[model samples]
Target: MITIGELGEKIVATWLEPQNYQILHHRWHCRWGEIDLIALDNHNSELVFMEVKTRKPQNWDQNGLEALNINKQKRIYTTAQIFLSKNPLWQNYNCRFDLILLTYIIRKNNSNQGLIKILNSNQIMYENYIFTIKNHLKNVL
Candidate 1:
């Protein structure tokens, strides 16, 4: 079963693909940590390391922003360095760190709610609470 976090990443990837970002890796892991998405921006020829935060509308930590503290930032930075080292081909590309925030909300009234059911079909979901892209902060780090 795909976890909610993984599903959120997939949704972000799906949205990014149509906008000229080619997903190079998903859930890229290393000793330090993992990168939710590694994408290449065709428009600018840049390498992007994206961190996704999915949460219900009502929660502490400012919808997961607080979770990316200095410690977490260090881990992600180190992981990105490792990735670039292993893939020398992208070493010359300008790199950036991005943040994607997803909020769980119901479609009927567009209110924050808990996720109920999800389907793996191309349609994304059947209708309860869905993760919506709340923000796309580029070059966050």
Candidate 2:
């Protein structure tokens, strides 16, 4: 059986398809890190690099979209750069970053719902898991 995380992505990708987006890559991993999905909108002539997070509950660090941190973003960006370098076709394409946060839910009746939440954030370019992105406790590091 496919894992719950994979299942969640399948559902999300399906939803993104009819919207006129072409899926270019999935689970693209390298020595630096992994990028969950890469899609392109041929009509708009834009590229979308996506990161996905899967969880079982509302248990994030806080009530904010800080699940993916600075360190992670840096790795993702580097991976994207490398992908383009290898695939010159996307070299001049305008690109944007996206985040897909999916929550895997379970029910009492042995059934569950795959709740997929999509967030589009280009501000976060790195990962800071232990602290707030706008500010930091200097001594903590």
Candidate 3:
């Protein structure tokens, strides 16, 4: 079975494909770390580095911005530089770094809350489950 990270990357790629992005790489590992998704916007001639996170109610990474920490940002930036070096012709194009957060809310009493995005990480109280976006605290040890 694929892990959550792997599945998250796939979902993100699928989400971006119809949006007109050419996915160049996913889970590109480097000395720094893994870049979730690297895409090329043909129409805009820009490169986009995206970080994706998915979570169940109890495991949600809130705001999803936590997925891109300072170190992760640096790694993505450095990796983009390396990629740029290999294709100098595209160096002049714009570069963007973004993030996507996926989370689900659940309740035993009510099953219709699945479409709502949980706003608070620690304060929500559901009948059976609560969704919370958490800060990214992955230690690169």
Tens digits of per-residue lDDT, candidate 3, 1-96, equal: 767556556655665675689998888766656678878877787777777776764443454555566777787778767767767876887888
Best by lDDT: 1
> What's the distance in Å from true for residue 58, model 2?
2.0
TM-score, one value per model: 0.83, 0.68, 0.64
Model 2 spans > 4 angstroms off: 62-64, 108-141
lDDT (Cα) of model 2: 0.59
Please write out the lDDT profile of model 2 over residues 40-106, one tens digit for every residue.
Answer: 9667878888765555555555322376678877888899898888889999998878766555444
TM-score of 2: 0.68
TM-score of 1: 0.83
Q: Which model is ahead, 1 or 2, in terms of lDDT?
A: 1
The number of clashing residue pairs in each candidate reads 0, 7, 4
Ranking by lDDT: 1, 3, 2
Model 1 lDDT-worst window of ten = 117-126
